[model samples]
Target: MLGPGAADVAFEVNGHPASVHVPPHHTLLDALRDELGLTGAKRVCDEGTCGACTVLVDGRPTYSCMTLAVACEGRSIETVEGLAHDGQLDPVQQAFIATDAYQCGFCTPGQIMSVVALLRANKAPTAEDVHRAVAGNLCRCGAYPGIVEAALRAARARRR
Candidate 1:
């Protein structure tokens, strides 16, 4: 059914379809960073504890580090690279920049992805919901308040 060392596999990245020949065990993070040169999805705790590797698989936030590249067949994947439109940052990204919601900036992409998913699901999220949505993303910079504020601001902007 298998061999010790296979050549590689291929998968579509972002919206463009392509095939990459990576080892069968190579993770989506490896494929994205090494094969596709899409480094937006950071590889933090590969065990899935950290949200740094977050990406959208069909509009849903998923840990790219833990997800196998093979599992993504025929599915649309969205990364932080896709958030900008015509050189303009998405609204949540803009709010995060205005609010200074990140420091050191290592976790900002995951944070922004969480906010994007939240706003996509709830146009008006309560404070508790905002907190709950970002619970999984850990910001070592201790910028939780700013992150919350950015989320609220994004919610407001979406409503207007």
Candidate 2:
């Protein structure tokens, strides 16, 4: 168990090993953003209701703001920043761009991360599946239609 003060927490982030000293009360969102400088996961709605801080913990969608940094030790954490490789965007990210799924873009990262997790579990997801995947993420601009379309498009693109 981690003490109240700063404790060393090591884990895999975006396929790379990372270690950070954080307090027991520090959240994974804070660790990712402040310690690791991964600002892709926005800090909106720090209460975990808006899903702006959604990230993949062990390949599952988790609210980083609600998850403690110490609790994530030994887990594989995937953020939106880690989705792309070799300068190529992930299909879901590309689809989001092609479909214009974002307006202000604050929630795009979390939405994309949720869809990525969904695609990992089901390569060809139905419309309902897409809805369920991004249900936790809220687009204040009301871009749900485009977000759903982008998810379906990404699923089709992954099939090829």
Candidate 3:
């Protein structure tokens, strides 16, 4: 049986099955970065206040820092590292680069993930939709305008 503080969590990450041993207290962010060596989710606030550790859990944006690893059992997780396929970057990523959506690059991953989720749900998102999606993500460099432009640009690109 699993111990009081540990458990074997099984989940799907980036379309791959993952089974890892983790402590009950371990956050998904820790599991992703430490155990799996997936560092796309940065450890910033570590309290969910900042969206640096944002990832997609079951198609919805989630703050991995606040989500327990054990609680993620049987769930599907998608990190920024998984956004690309066959050597092609996700459209959101391309748009972020094209629009200069980031500076210092600390919050770019989270912002991109949020926009990815938004674009998945709404292929054509308005400025308000983009704002609402990334509302929780904080860009210390004051790159909100570029971020919004990137999201809109990605949405339009997806339509082509």
Top-scoring candidate (TM-score): 2
Q: Per-prediction TM-score, please?
A: 0.91, 0.98, 0.97
Q: Best candidate, lDDT-wise? A: 2
Using lDDT as the measure, name the better of candidate 2 and candidate 3.
2
Give lDDT tens digits, candidate 1, residues 50-118: 799888888888888888776665777788898888899898999998999988998888888888898
Q: What global local distance difference test value does model 2 have? A: 0.95
Question: TM-score of model 1 relative to the true fold?
Answer: 0.91
lDDT of each: 0.83, 0.95, 0.94
Which stretches in model 2 have alpha-carbon errors above 4 Å?
Answer: none
**Candidate 1: clashing pairs of residues:** 8-21, 8-22, 9-22, 10-20
Where's the lowest-lDDT run of ten residues in candidate 1?
1-10
TM-score of 3: 0.97
Per the 3 Å backbone cut-off, how many clashing residue pairs does candidate 2 have?
Answer: 0
